[model samples]
Target chain A: MHPVAVVNANGASPIVFVCEHASNNIPNMYHELGLNAADKISHAAYDPGALGVLRCLVNEFDAVGVYGTVSRLIYDCNRPPEAASAMPAKSEKIIVPANANITPAERDARTNAVYVPFTNTLADIIAQKGGQGIVITIHSFTPTYFDEPRHVEIGVIHDDDPTLASACVTELQGDGSFVCEINEPYSREDGVAHTLNLHGTKNGLQNAMIEVRNDLIATPDDEMKMGIYLAQQLRKTFKSLGIDLNEVSA
Target chain B: MHPVAVVNANGASPIVFVCEHASNNIPNMYHELGLNAADKISHAAYDPGALGVLRCLVNEFDAVGVYGTVSRLIYDCNRPPEAASAMPAKSEKIIVPANANITPAERDARTNAVYVPFTNTLADIIAQKGGQGIVITIHSFTPTYFDEPRHVEIGVIHDDDPTLASACVTELQGDGSFVCEINEPYSREDGVAHTLNLHGTKNGLQNAMIEVRNDLIATPDDEMKMGIYLAQQLRKTFKSLGIDLNEVSA
Candidate 1:
């Protein structure tokens, strides 16, 4: 079974956006870490309104969006199962009660149920698109991790498809309102290429994971504004490069 | 965390044998579908007497054995997550009760917990051996599928690394007691190249999955005899090919 979300639109749009870490919902079986409803609704549970951006992008551009339903704290959809962060030991400095001291049986269950389907979904979506569409993943990162402050306004990550990501970086850089980095503030070599490595490089697809500071997309308004900005910028960049987004068929 | 089963040697031998489908036990959480205890103990749960053969191989060759703990029925450790049979819809004509109508959350759990860790365990073993050891996966297959009878007494499955599998097939064919089929009864394209594709092809290692008729290895005596026969034939084949199994070290 495929793990990705498909928008079955027969359009000529060249881009498909995937939000691997768009949600952070813990299973109902997994309690709220002894926290209140408001705490659960915080950035800890979901991506703090990243789905709004995805929704806007789908409506504005002829594209599909694929995402994971479970929290990355359970099993990171963006990471390979072998990666340490795939099933992180901790999240937001709060100990994940269920993840502590996982047994072999427990580990097997998570892999079979979550990680496999998530990647399979992305692969199937790409296959269904006939391998011609470009892939752009939308994500939000915290302003800081532990005590380390992050500097870049936006980070574009790509493994084999640096062309599009580079163009995006250049476009955002030239814009006075934002500061953009290509494979920086964070980069792919740091093991962020897990999803792209398996789904993109393995299958020779053009893909990138774009990270926006969570603070920039913390509300519905912010998500919609950024979504429109990104869609316009990406479309302009692709157009300038003589690549026609409309040339892609469903 | 890696999932590994290691059997160390108490004697002076420098070889190690690996079995991919050594165990097939579904978790207690996934109750057996109307099957009795004896049915669970049958080939459906584990390779039919693979442990006995693997034990005999270790003794005859004086080596170590590393295997997976859970059954492939849960998630075939040998398959890539994208493969259809990685998590089969049915097992031995019996529907997997827990696997039916699996949600996205359930899919991620299985792939993250079971499939990834199992492959990681195998990877760690190969890395520790420093790429100097022979990797062989022992498996048993039914005499027939549906109503179609299989004629070959033995089959070797290989993906790109036809060197080892091909050699073994030649040696078994030379033995009058067995009819050997190279890359058959099933081909690598037949969805059995899980371990081979990831561990061998992706990592550039020499490996082969050996399929002995289930009936041939069902009994202890028969298992021991086949193990000895396979070990001797493999030794001869390696010698003829000038491949040194002992050269693999940490």
Candidate 2:
């Protein structure tokens, strides 16, 4: 199976959905990157409920979805090749043994095998939409990191271009659904905005990165609820931005 | 005028030619970034003859060409926004007054105005070519830097992936025309491979960066000769790579 998976590749919608941390399943070739069974399925491997939310949103808008099929521990699709976190030697407190002091050739192998296909398919799909494409990346963070609790439930993040994110934050806040803020938890300075910077702001695409607290999206039903609510808010976001959804290549 | 110029946007060829430092004309809005007339047109502002060669190659193979239309002093499209050289305050000996002490907002303005459009156009064009795209970035460097003389006439450079660069270097050396060497003059370690790494290696495209001495390509006629020779060698390189030119798009 390919490291990247695309759903509704020819979807008519102008919106492109990306889930960089969609799976915790490491490929057999990686041998779980030297992690134990429990640690392999940890949030470090993938965003626990992000894929479920992405699927619902893809169906909600008939948007094209591109997601990672292998563990981000192998290669984080959101990171640039030069970034250390792209293939982290230490993700949080857990040390990734296989990633420790990896050679340049070994690093290139993972990048070629995983990051390339994921990004190319995304770039191709967005190109097929011409100038009307909007990108929205979904992710979920742990309720706590390093014994510190994160209060922000949803993050509406943007880098460089804030048109979509500013509007989404307003819509999310107005809805009173959950605690939402701009650039909370992780910002562009944190090196978490690689996807938003590369595919969205760099391409002049109206884009936003949405992060939900994992506790809020722990189950399939929760994912469905969050996805439906977020979709409504996003639709309203476009409207507030003076964009006509009906005319936006649905 | 747009910061980026795309020639033959719908060309059937599988090659996407990029000239990041194509022009030395800073827009009126920038006021030449506080440089004098001579300094504004210096090799530091833009590559002297890279665009000429790129145009010749684009015509030779009917390949799509995406080039920067503004001076690199305003924003180097080849460098990422976070890179200091993207809008360098001090380029060689000339200090750019406007770029010095620039705030984040000021930086973002230039990135949005110049870098974003230029990269988006190139990325879009490459995506249009699908999986068969080959990226070749054209650049020209000064014969001397910081009072030190250089001997290499043409530098064939690569980053993580060396497939295309190695093949092209072998072909260039076999021809016995120019002093061509693999990763000569400047290698990936010199931070000159941003374009090659970002748009080329990151996407898994067969890619190489060709750097010719500015003195060698000073005239339009010289650019044409160099272009024709490089094009032929690239054709041979593709043949050696087991890629049938006839089977490729165009």
Say which candidate scores most in lDDT: 2
lDDT of 1: 0.69
Q: After superposing candidate 1, which stretches have Cα over 4 Å from the reference? A: A1-4, A7-12, A32-39, A42-45, B1-250
CAPRI-style docking class of model 1 based on DockQ: incorrect
In order, what is each prediction's RMSD in angstroms? Answer: 21.5, 24.5
Per-residue C-alpha lDDT of model 2 across residues A1-250, encoded as one tens digit per residue = 4788787787788899999998775767887788986677678888977886897799788889998877788899999999999999887788889999889998999999989998898888888888788899999998999999999999988889888999999988998879999998888898888887888887888888999998776543456568988999998998889887558784
Report, to 2 decimal places, the DockQ of model 1: 0.01
| Tens-digit per-residue lDDT, A1-250, candidate 1 | 1234454244356566777665545555557445454444455544654665776687678677777766676677777776766776566765565666777776767777788888877777778777786777777777887778878878888887688788878888877467788886567877777777777767776778788887776433356568888888887778767777666656
Candidate lDDT scores, in order, read 0.69, 0.84
Candidate 2 stretches with Cα past 4 Å from truth are B1-250
Q: Candidate 1's residue-wise lDDT over B185-221, tens digit each?
A: 7777778776777666676667788888876764334
